[model samples]
Target: MLRDIDPILSPDLLHALRAMGHGDEIVIADANFPAEGLGPRCIRADGSSASDMLRAALSVLPLDTFVPDPAHSMAVVDDPDAIPEAVADFQRIIDDTADHPARIAPLERFAFYERAASAFAVIQTGERRLYGNIILKKGVIAP
Candidate 1:
């Protein structure tokens, strides 16, 4: 238990967040995500919802302001325009927690998987909702 830190953020997760540099990306993935096979390191957030994990991560990780879209979510198959309930929750959480105003850009299913595979790390959450996955780019803290 650290002071002011969300309990949901385990030690390993905190280490990953702290170790990431500006522009490095991390994925907060749903239960269905194949995090283990992804090239990057995987952290398990079992029993935690995607929204809960997102909120906890955003509490300390700053979103990259250099990029137009610092956050991303998987798009519903064949319906790029449709926002699933979990994706909507992700937007709300980002809106509430990010240092700057930002929205989660929708990524094609394969595109999203490719991005996740290249991320600095993947936090696999136990969220059962389809398409609850999200990716966040790390940003530098202003001096």
Candidate 2:
């Protein structure tokens, strides 16, 4: 066990977060997400909620400040304005963890899937909520 590290963060997830460079993105996906067929490497966070997993990841991974939007979540299908309960949970976690208040931009299903495929890695959580998927871009640590 490492000092001060959230036990929810598996070793593989920690490695991926550490290996990612500034602006590299990582997706914290729901169980329904097509993570397996996506191109990016996938890490399983089975039995964990998406919000819990997101908090664990954000504990160590800094969000990119260079971009106007460093956080993203999948928008409800056919209802872009709809905010799923899970997405709200994700936003709460992001707001609490980020250096500044962060807004989680909503993306259409296909766009979200495409972005996930191009992310540095995907952490598939066991969260059963629809539209629970969220993407976070890594940022450099201040010197």
TM-score of each: 0.98, 0.97
User: Which ten contiguous residues of candidate 1 have the minimum total lDDT?
Assistant: 92-101
Full-model lDDT for every candidate: 0.94, 0.90
Q: What is the lDDT of residue 79 in candidate 1?
A: 90
lDDT accuracy of residue 26 in candidate 1: 99
lDDT of 2 by residue, 1-143 (tens): 89999998889989999999999999999998899999899999988999999888888888888899999999888899999999999888888987655799999889999898999999999999988899999988899
**What tens digits encode model 1's per-residue C-alpha lDDT throughout 1-143?**
99999999999999999999999999999999999998899999998999999999999999999999999999999999999999999998888888885988999999999998899999999999999999999988999
Clashes of each: 0, 0
Query: Best-fitting candidate, measured by TM-score?
Result: 1
Q: Could you tell me how far off, in angstroms, the CA of residue 135 lies in candidate 1 after the best superposition? A: 0.4
Candidate 2 weakest lDDT stretch, 10 residues: 93-102
What are the per-model C-alpha RMSD values against the true structure? 0.6, 0.8
Would you list the clashing residue pairs of candidate 1?
A: none
Error of 2 at 21 (Å): 0.2
Model 1, which residues run further than 4 Å from truth? Answer: none
